[model samples]
Target: MIFLLGLALLRGRVGDREAWHCGAVLIHPRYVLTAGHCVRDPNIPNLSLLGVRLGELNLTTNPDCQLGLCSSVVDVGVEQILVHPEYNRACLACHDLALVRLSRAIENLLPQIYPICLPLDPEGELGGSTDALHNSRDWGWIAGWGSVSGDPFNAQLPTVLQKAQVPLTPTPFCDALQQRYPDPSSTLCAGGEGPFTCKGDSGGPLMIDNRMRTRWYVLGITSKGPRVCGAPNTQTLFTNVHHHLSWILSNLRP
Candidate 1:
């Protein structure tokens, strides 16, 4: 597990227990992007949402440090959580994203606990267009501190953050999964054979570097996948951010 920046861990209290609920990305100083289900899923109940913890590399230690350097884990309160209106848990398809507005601004934090860049119109083509997404080479970076093993509660959670580079799988790959996987236009599939995300990795970012590798862009948000992650011929599903750019732009507020 390597140190991945711009990743935020959504923490909350569940009936006297503090838990890392889901993953999120810092897009703006005062706004974080996550999955709709993360904010409102009846299956995951009784979670008294607290805030987000940023600039973290390890979860087992306080003030995670390495090579004689340490990070000040910033915990900011959540001012509001806006789940996409079109999101429906029953369908488990499109519109499975959310936006979180922080109680205060995080402009001061940069180059450390900073925010990642959103996709922009490149080469006159719309951002997230089918052409642009495929023009780039395969694979995107996925990082998180989620469970390293089986069922979230029953599995072993990683002490250090985990990172993986998974190739952008095709629509057929997802369709063959035989699950109620959403349409490729709104969702994407990756890591079908092996090295897929496990439970507790939802709402996390699927990132890709710019042409010059100067900046990271959130390509997708971890949504759903097989219960037995890493199973043969199984893949993880992600909500394509490019497909929801309009909704995201209109909802972002400081």
Candidate 2:
């Protein structure tokens, strides 16, 4: 599960105790790709970021191991932040994407905290390629630490990692929603009923396995879903990472 958590807060107010809320990961060696809203409203002075505990699926345990099995770890702080230049809070379109630059490399601490590969062709829309994705059914994985239910606006961070299944809908079905939202060119849609992303799930991964190899690949970053959480027949929108590959590489590389 190559997942990252993110949030925004008045920068200086965060204490050492609030590690989980401040965490993010490097989508590139130098750049941190997270939800655009994560770093919104930079008017506050004290901005901070923390690194997640990799390989540790459960985050509920105490860091000191006093309560339960705790993992010995050192969380790193972010040095700089860069939300997408095009981000707009009003429409919630292309600006939903963001990036952060860390002070140092976290590779040694948790190698598994590596970047998920972007698709070879981002705009190659998944709808037309039914033959390739068909055998796998409409199933896909959505991982995050969002609230279990209720409170559509507020979200609960998971003590333990959480994951759910999301089914793929036809392009025609997605097009209808896209018309209403007019999302970024890099957007993708998934979900129907039963399984969907909630409030805290934003900026997480929607993973799908290769039909032939069964290898897991991240399809997109979990974005919005029906405005309110867990609405029936509502689909989640994600920024198609593949579509922004060049932009990401250029910005994050140097």
Candidate 3:
């Protein structure tokens, strides 16, 4: 996997056993944006919350693919977790997004642990309509250290760098699916059946890794999928980063 500058990846475990599930990244030095579902736990208090680790990409060289035995974490009190105010995990559409701000600014970190550049308004619209991303058969990259497959415990944690080719689903088709499934604000869909992004990969970035100047600017965050991983009708849903650009920037500013 190719590593780039100013891309801070987030990783944490389920329970306390260290099964690294997914990642989020810094959109600004003070705020970290990830999938709302990633931080969801009905019973836990914010005080008992875990800290976020920054930096550390080892896909191509690290044999075990582990971030390291121990990682640096800040006791980020949830302060406020803006879970897409509209998000209903059951409905799974408009509210799949969320933002978390640290109680204080993080200090003394290298550029690798810096924030990612978010696209400005209309920038995300530069590509065509949602239908294009869904049906065109164009290919983009999804990054995460999640399991390559879903055999549960069969796969190890801090998974190897794996990627798959996915075709965009037509917006009309997605709209119909949304009507039936009922996520009206749905924007784009990709991946069907095997070789798609999965459980431990929520909130990860969907990017064009071919560029030389900028690392994949995030277009979407892994939002939803079928009950079973990669089912034919089951496609991965993402929050169109472009649509929420203004909301993101307003919050980022102090």
Per-prediction TM-score:
0.87, 0.71, 0.70
The candidate that wins on TM-score is 1
Q: What is the C-alpha lDDT of each candidate?
A: 0.76, 0.55, 0.56
Cα RMSD (angstroms) for every candidate in the order listed: 3.0, 5.5, 5.2
lDDT of 3 by residue, 119-224 (tens): 5522243344434444443666666666565554465445344555565553343555566444454445666645777666777766543235344456677776
Highest lDDT model number: 1
Better of 2 and 3 by TM-score: 2
Clashing pairs in 1: none
Residue 88 error, candidate 1, Å: 0.6
Q: Give every collision pair in model 2.
A: 11-46, 11-47, 12-46, 22-50, 87-95, 186-240
What lDDT, from 0 to 1, does candidate 1 have? 0.76
- lDDT (Cα, tens digit) per residue for candidate 1, span 1-254: 12535699898777889889799999988888998878877566776668987888877677777776677678889999888888874475457898999998876655467788776663333244533565455777888877777554477778788889877756565776425544446776777654678877899998877656667788789998778777677778888887788999999875
Candidate number that wins on TM-score, 1 or 2: 1
Q: Which model, 2 or 3, shows the larger lDDT? A: 3
Model 2, 1-254: lDDT tens digits are 33322211112234444434322334555555666655553443353444433334556453424234334443455667667666665464554666666566645433334555455542243333433452345777777666776466566656666677877653555666567554435577887677667766666776665545323555666656676666655677776666556666767644
